[model samples]
Target: MKRVIYGLFNRLRFKHKLFLSYLLVIFIPIMVLGVYSYKQSEQMLNMQAIQGIEKNVDTISESIDGSVERYNHTIQSIVYNKTFQKIVTNDYLDLVNLSYDLKEYLTPYLNMMVMLDKEIDQVTFYTQTYVPEYGDSVLSAARVENEQWYKDAMNKTGSQWFFEDGLFVVSKFPRFFADKATNLVYMRVNDDSLFKNVTDLAKDYSVAIADEQGRVIYSNQSASKNTLDADALIRMNEGALMVGGAESFLVKKAVRQTGWTIYCIVPAVQVSPNVGSIINATLIIIGACMLGVLIIIWIFSKTMIRRIYSLNVWMKRVEIGDLRMRIRSDSKDEIGELTNRFGTMLIRLNELIDELYRNKIVQKEAEFKALQWQMNPHFLYNTLSFINWKALKSEAYDISHIVTTLSKFYRTGLNRGDNIIPVRDELEHIKSYIEIIQIMKDYSFDVTYEIDEAVFDYTTINFILQPLAENAIKHGINRKTTGRGMLRIKAKLGDRTVEFTVEDNGEGMPPETAKTIMQNQCSGYGLKNVNERLQLRFGSDYSIAVESIAGSCTLMKIIIPQNIQS
Candidate 1:
């Protein structure tokens, strides 16, 4: 009998099958049992509402504490910076040095602090001694000596928080400098950032932030008649409260960094609607269940049909040689699984194409190696060394030196067919290239190396620096018409990376020309080849960066991971 019923069900149309399923599965059960379920749901909803509001208040408190901690860290960093301490503590006998110090150190330091932390609106230093004010950053102590907030900060030993004119201000004295205790550092927090979480609450909900002494600092419902009292909420902790003769839910959380409290209140009526009205609505809903079930079945059938049609369209596109076509569905049904499988197939096809392209590159590299073997590099190096010795014996010193340098350049460049070598070798190769250029150009340009000793321990791709040095001399230094051009090469250790820069002070190109120099074939093949090789070896993240100013200078920077292996 079960098999017969299943066969009969399978014979029905799709919409008819959906109709019967909804009627037998949903309509009858709900009509018989929905009344009790609706009454029970009301109590559960009220409990959930209370728990949700409590969680929201806790989250807001945590967010505010996080902002406060970051602000405090910024303040400490500024107070401990050596440049800041020197600027404040120095007794200036000459205004010339003071002006230079402020311009060279203080201005840049303060600007960096402000840039690093977006929450800081302004940073100002107050000094007791007579000094010329540079801008809003430095001011005389007399401007705020009479103010209560400034006086409190002067007497305080640690950081203090205060609210003035809607801005949150942090003030402290530098503990390391005893004689400069009266000197103060004030960092003002952006007002919008401090109260962003509080203002995000629902319109029916009220939020307030207050100090330890119960003075309200911020209130989202300040202009409304339903604003909560900060002191009353603090005393009550968590419970129901009477506001304007109506009961409201109240929850409070304390900010850990600043000794402040966050208070949240909402009307109790909003938590759960009237239960009687809900029961009356349930009876009407039951009367309409049959029609509702039919409507739902129609909507479900149409939705499934539309999704299936979309999948069919995608399949057709894929069949017509459009492998990139894709379709997405959030449904957990069989059709959704089929669509996901199709997307996976497309990805596999693309991967296969990429593999073929890489194989071609490898084949070409093998051919190039076969050509390199045709010429014997060792015999050439030996011939050059013999000629150098003959020239030195003949007292032709310049020819001998040139021959020696040329041999060195080729030995380093070949590097036993290895792609990677020590940074020291690469530097030596560039030095050889530079010596040859200086001789050819009659020493018209000056070259300087400011390499850090630590960089010699790292390894990089071979023949990278020689091309960059060649470009600097051919394109930059040789174009200068005035004084002797300058070329500087620098290498230093960075955070988990090594940085190499080649800069030349000569005729430079326009900004647009510099921007496309790497991609433009006419600029030079050397720069583009270097960029592509770095990207292929490391990743797209490691590449060469170019900066230039017209008629001034040009700089090329290459950065790579310090821990890279050969």
Candidate 2:
């Protein structure tokens, strides 16, 4: 049998295998847990119902005890009252005096007792002395002498409760008056006030207050012939009972003030009425969980199989030499990751093939451009030197000086095609260009160089300063009208950086022009080119900044790192 089952499982597809595994791992366990939970819940609900019945019995007992204590205290108060003793024991001379004594002392005292306690229905005084009937509050003892409760109270020493038609307490008063005139204080309470708590319980529940003799004094349930035996309930104390041939839950609580027991009986079926519903709900939940498991397994298997098949097709294309195929998946699962990796591999393979051939072509072009660039700078320098020599031979000394300065400027600007040069060489290049400008303009503008000697040790991008000086003379110094055009070049050294400032006393450009001068095409390539080269070589931290005041002065500052390698 095991072999047969294994063979059948092995023959199934992956999705079928996964579905079977889910049933074994998830569905069966859920069903078992559902059954176990139902059994536990039923037991717990039964225990809770029993506890609730017990609690109700205790509450009824406490309420009855409180009423009994209150009645006993009231009876004691009446028995010990001096005015009540005087009114009952006084020898009346005539009917008028009797009426006056009753009205002035006895009637008001009884009325006060009843008014003070809302629970006390009426207080009646019964006396055997020849006192005419004075309403129900002063009743004659001759009327109740034949009553069993009256006989019992007279026989007893203290207060006694009698549950006849209604609940009442009887007590003999004026113990000091030993004359054999029967005197008793009778207090009656409304029956509803004693049994109010029990009436709020469920109809199926029966509550009974049983005296010490085990007779039912009060019961919320109607007195039927087949009522539960209160004697058996008191003796049994608690647990199961039989009511009308049906098993019931019984709870008993003792009223301490009165030697009575409160009995609460609940039908067993009422204790856990929702047991069937719990079983049905558990079965429904198990069915839902099993159905959900099957659906999830199916969806998961279908999605995984589809993605794997797609990935296989892509791999097949790559195997057949097609590297341009593209695929994308937004899922973050393992299969999606594998698919993405495969697509990336194909793309990188294509890029490497193109980059290999393109790099070779770029290498040859760069070599040719390097050769061309090398020839042009040297040829221009040689031509400039030749012009200077000719001007010297013609005794044109100023022309020769201008030509020599221009040659020196171009030589320092090229720097053998290297972008980085010492600070001294950069200064020399800009100085040579400025000398050429001064001679051409006939020394119109005064030039000052306040260069710190320590800055010559650092390195900077070549040809950066020459263009700024040229812009200063052409745009700034030449436009000055009120004062002599002064051009100042200052270099300062700091802890980790070097700063160069180019200032001019020419008619300075507008604030807006200075702000956008580097970005504007009409501003020419000198400042913009220098800014770009400095930024590209040393990042934005070592770029040029322009600050100008219209009609006053224009200042261009260049900052560069001091520790740069030459």
Give the alpha carbon lDDT tens digit for every residue of 329-366 in model 1.
Answer: 67789999888887888889878977986885566445
Model 1 lDDT at residue 308:
81
Clashing residue pairs in candidate 1, if any? none
Please give, for residues 303-322, the per-residue lDDT of candidate 2 as tens digits.
77777888898888888988
Instruction: Give the residue spans of candidate 1 off by over 4 A.
Output: 1-13, 37-278, 281-344, 347-351, 360-364, 367-375, 522-525, 563-566
Off by over 4 Å in 2: 1-34, 91-98, 112-119, 128-133, 177-182, 202-204, 221-237, 280-566
Model 1 scores a C-alpha lDDT of: 0.78
lDDT of 2 at 144: 87
lDDT to native, each model: 0.78, 0.79
Mind sharing the TM-score for model 2?
0.42
Clashes of 1: 0
- Residue 167 lDDT in candidate 2: 80
What lDDT score goes with residue 435 in model 1? 90
The clash numbers for all candidates, in the given order, read 0, 0
